[model samples]
Target: MSIAISTALQSSFADAVTRTREALAGQGFGVLTEIDMKATLKAKLDQDMENYLILGACNPPLAHRAVDIDRQIGLLLPCNVVVRTDPDDDTRVLVEAMNPQLLVQVTGDPALQEVADEVTAKLRAAIQALGPTSG
Candidate 1:
């Protein structure tokens, strides 16, 4: 199975977050929501956890174009990216997204597939510019 692009980096938790948001925006994506996992877990379970943030990002034009081709593509809308702390207390972040090719299989729409492929590469470039290589 092909896992999503994940990576570790040496940066402050806040810096990682800011950089991620900036990079995503720079690449034409806008952050739709920010989920603070650590705060949520602590508030609900009274458990202390490392810093973790979830970012819901979307590119309006591309997304609209994709949905035009395959209305069901909404299932894959708003790509998710995460920022979390490592064991050593350093910050790391990862972006988990469905493979665009898989979306092609589901939608069976060539144009929609093209959009997914381009978005995937754009997201990859955004993450790589911010941290360690993801293999």
Candidate 2:
């Protein structure tokens, strides 16, 4: 399975980030944390990079269900969604979300299958809501 559910949009990086947040919220996810990778790296390592933001999104009900099935699941809690400018094309931006199904694969737990499938569906819907994917 693909590691991330993603889409490439022909949009400004700022616009892409706004739309991504709206999409995730529409799917019942809230951003618990936001990390501006570009800023952080520049300040810490004096390294420059394309505009990049990492959103730690969570759907509480689904997260609770998964955690109930396995306590250690918190390690993977709060799905990561990345909105960044495409390195090769300044006008193109990429939005990507972690594939929840990986949790079932990594944990090798059949019990998580239902929750994983549900989360995967919600995540896919959110990504699709952004707009037509160029790639």
Candidate 3:
């Protein structure tokens, strides 16, 4: 199965990040943490790159359900959503999220399928709400 669900937005990187957060929030997911990859790389290694950010998003109810089924699931909790400019085309911004189904697939646990399915749907909706996407 595909590992990520993503969309391309015709907006500046900063605008895309804001819209991505709003879209995820509309789907009942909240940003629990954020990492500014561009700044980190520049500061630590004096490297330069396109704007990039990772938002740790979580739906508390869904997260709680998954953890109840498998304590180790926290390792994958707060699904990561990345907002970055396309390296090949700086004019385009990409918003991508981890496919929630991976949790069930990796664990090989049928019980977690239900929660994964729910999260997958919500994540899909969040990506769709952003704008047009390509497979």
Candidate 4:
């Protein structure tokens, strides 16, 4: 089962980044953190690397309920979305979510899986929307 869904865009990195932000915001998530992997590597390791940005997005109400059911589940909240170049030399943006089903195993809370699946769908939709600027 694929936990992530991705689409390659013909547009430049900046355009894709802008669309990614908009798509996520439309789905009730706000970017809590943005890590520029390329810039971080160059600054710390002195290596020029391809552009990679990590968007840590979160939806508040769902998270509050999920954590109330199981405190340790916070480790998985605010799912990760990665936008970067793949190894094949093709620039691709990837959004990976914590599998909704897996939450049931870890915490034994089926209610949380429902919430996770909803976010997963939105994340996939956002990735799809970034694919050509068309709808």
Q: Pick the candidate with the highest TM-score.
A: 3
Candidate 3, 1-135: lDDT as tens digits: 889999998898889988998999999999999999999999999999999999999999999999999999999888999999999999999999999999999999999999999999999999999998654
Q: List the residue pairs that clash in candidate 2.
A: none
lDDT of 1 at 78: 76
Task: List, in order, the clash count of every candidate structure.
Answer: 0, 0, 0, 0
Judged by whole-model lDDT over C-alpha atoms, candidate 2 comes out at 0.93
Per-model CA lDDT versus the true structure? 0.75, 0.93, 0.93, 0.71
Local error of candidate 3 at residue 17 (angstroms): 0.8
TM-score of model 3 vs. true structure = 0.97
Segments in model 3 whose C-alpha atoms lie over 4 Å from true places: none
Better of 1 and 3 by lDDT: 3
Superpose all Cα atoms of candidate 3 onto the true structure and report the RMSD in Å to 1 decimal.
0.8
Q: Write candidate 1's Cα lDDT for 1-135 as tens digits.
A: 344656676777788788888888888999998899899999999988788788888989888888888788888777788778884644444444444566676667777767878887878788787867564
Of the candidates numbered 1 and 4, which has the greater lDDT value? Answer: 1
TM-score ranking, best first: 3, 2, 1, 4
Show where candidate 2 strays beyond 4 Å. 133-135
Model 2 TM-score on a 0 to 1 scale: 0.97
Worst window of 10 by summed lDDT in candidate 1? 90-99
